[model samples]
Target: MASNVSDPAGARRPVIGLTTYLERATQGVWDVRASFLPQQYFDAVTASGGVAVLLPPQPAAQAAASVVLDGLDGLILTGGLDVQPELYGAARHPLTDPARADRDEWELALLAGARERGIPVFGICRGLQLINVAYGGTLHQHLPEALGTERYKIGGGVFAENTVDVDASTKLAGLIGAGPYGVHSYHHQGVDRLGEGLVVTARTDDGLVQAFEAPGDDYLVAVQWHPEENSADRRLFLGLVAAADAYAVSHRGVSA
Candidate 1:
């Protein structure tokens, strides 16, 4: 299993599974639906001292998710399309991306499996939204409409910047330190209602929930900003990787 794989430095690197995008992609003379994720995600995991594994959308089944997670010490729900509004009993907003039902279902299943197995999980952007919905929370659907500003998402591929204040007592605060911390932003929806058992760890000046985590000692952090975008500072990835390493140690004992 990947959790047992050692780096060239002879140190064990915990296996971390990262979810990817399922989209129509084109390269060279090929245009087809593809399961892919940004290289930055992979880089962050490895740079944080963990092995990265891309988990693309698969046939959504609890059994399948369980099987997949059995080999992983940590799980990351990467950023992507908006979660289906119907999951939270709301009509789809015009600004919401067309439902990527397959991805949603698969990722949701994976999340459930992660919870059942007590695997450390990190959610980024859409990953945050899905985690909220999975816990019976609702989304604002469109932040511009809800907040009446385009600040959260300045169009174009460029990412906007925002500062969020972290609660001084949360684990996130301990990891990233107290703030008013700057972060990369590019999302149209925000958490409208916090999910059950989820503790709000950070928020922006506009009162949008920017970071949260399920209540536990085991890592389960979710941030709305794109940490992978800023490779210069990988505190979030490092936190997850550290928790993953601990999990790997406890689960299977340190691999030789």
Candidate 2:
């Protein structure tokens, strides 16, 4: 465990856990060293006055979760490959590029454990989808086929901007404001059936679900956008880190 650092006012800084990915090849031999995530993720969290820690890919690895959860104030589920559909009782699509099943299982366990313990969580892109499926929800599998439109592209290009309508009265709306905001979209899968205790908080112009949140919770937010790609969009990390800071202050009696 790392030492807890106090802010200038003597409040303990929140520790934010960010998920990672595994590097696998089409052929044989998986190299563990190949795993990586962009540093902007850490920069975002740290910039928001939170300490960032990388949660390595260890699916079905509950021990890893326990270790990471301890001494951490929040969890951020970062983006990655498509989750294996079988975990959520669905068949894999032909286009599905399966991510690490073990890592998925571990993260799901981590999410369940975190919620039970009142830890704040921020899910982005694939992270959002994973959280939904873990809680008895399903995904579209392939957005283009499901939506019958190509207005949203999920691959191969620089980040593109799109608008997301915010649901007033939701934490997301409070953070980003009541009107539409430009967001970066880059996913083929989206929430098809919302999970229990979850509510849609934002959507694209085409009516695709862009974000959701756990009602009444201060920090369980999931969005299908890459805010880290655009730090100028400070609302994304600010909202999450602020909630996390509050959680830490309330539970641990430390100021953020």
Candidate 3:
């Protein structure tokens, strides 16, 4: 076990545990169905001065998810498959892809655990949806039927560029700066009903829920856009690492 002491270099780097994708993937010399994630997330965390750790899904993962979070400084719910509508008490839409139940089950557990531990959490895309569901919220299963356009998602494995209007009074406005900001979006579902203690911090011209934060002020902020996709401005990742650093300093004077 690591000691409860700070190293000048190592201690400053907060350990951010990122959720991974349990799906089929192909790479250089190997192709297999397993736990994986796009490196963009890890890269963002690393570039922002944090050590990225993978939180892989396994049997009984959720049962002990909170315990695992105790060892982490921060958590990033990365973008992935659609969440199960049944979990949110809604029927699935025709164009909606089948929900990744295994991922959903494990992530919900992680969310419950993280919230219990008061871990700093940043959710991106699917991650945002999961956060909403975890708080007893409903989802707009398909945007096309709801909005009459696929503007939010360009499909064919591409992200659409859009603008967001920020709520000036929210904490998110302080981090990313407000008003008519450009963002990268690639989702067909969005928050249809408000979650417990969640405040809408940003949205698009179409009035879809673009960003939200739980009001307790514990570094809990999630955006429908992918900040990891934009490498240049990494205030979101920086914010998470900074909060994790503070969490480490205030908790046990140690960092994973």
lDDT score for candidate 2 against the true structure: 0.81
Question: Mind giving the per-residue lDDT tens digits that candidate 3 earns over 145-175?
Answer: 8889899899898889999999997878988
- List the candidate 3 regions with Cα displacement exceeding 4 Å: 1-11, 27-31
Best by lDDT: 1
Decide which is better by lDDT, 2 or 3: 3
Question: How many Å off is the CA of 45 in candidate 1?
Answer: 0.8
| Candidate 2 per-residue lDDT over residues 1-256, each given as its tens digit | 3334667887667788888876543446644455567888899998887888887767447776776677778899998888888878888899787557767887887897788778899999999999999878998888879988655564576676788999899888888887788888777788888888889999987788899999775579999988888877677788877777777777776644
| C-alpha positional error of residue 235 in candidate 2 after TM-score superposition, expressed in Å | 1.4
Candidate 1, residue 211: CA error in Å?
Answer: 0.4
* Cα lDDT for residue 155, candidate 2: 54
Per-model TM-score, in order, reads 0.96, 0.90, 0.92
- Winner on lDDT (1 vs 2): 1
lDDT score, candidate 3, position 117: 70
Q: Candidate 3 has what TM-score?
A: 0.92
Model 1 lDDT at residue 30:
100
58-160 per-residue lDDT for model 1 (tens digits): 8746667888898999999999889999999998888889988888998999999888777899999999999999999999998888999988889898899
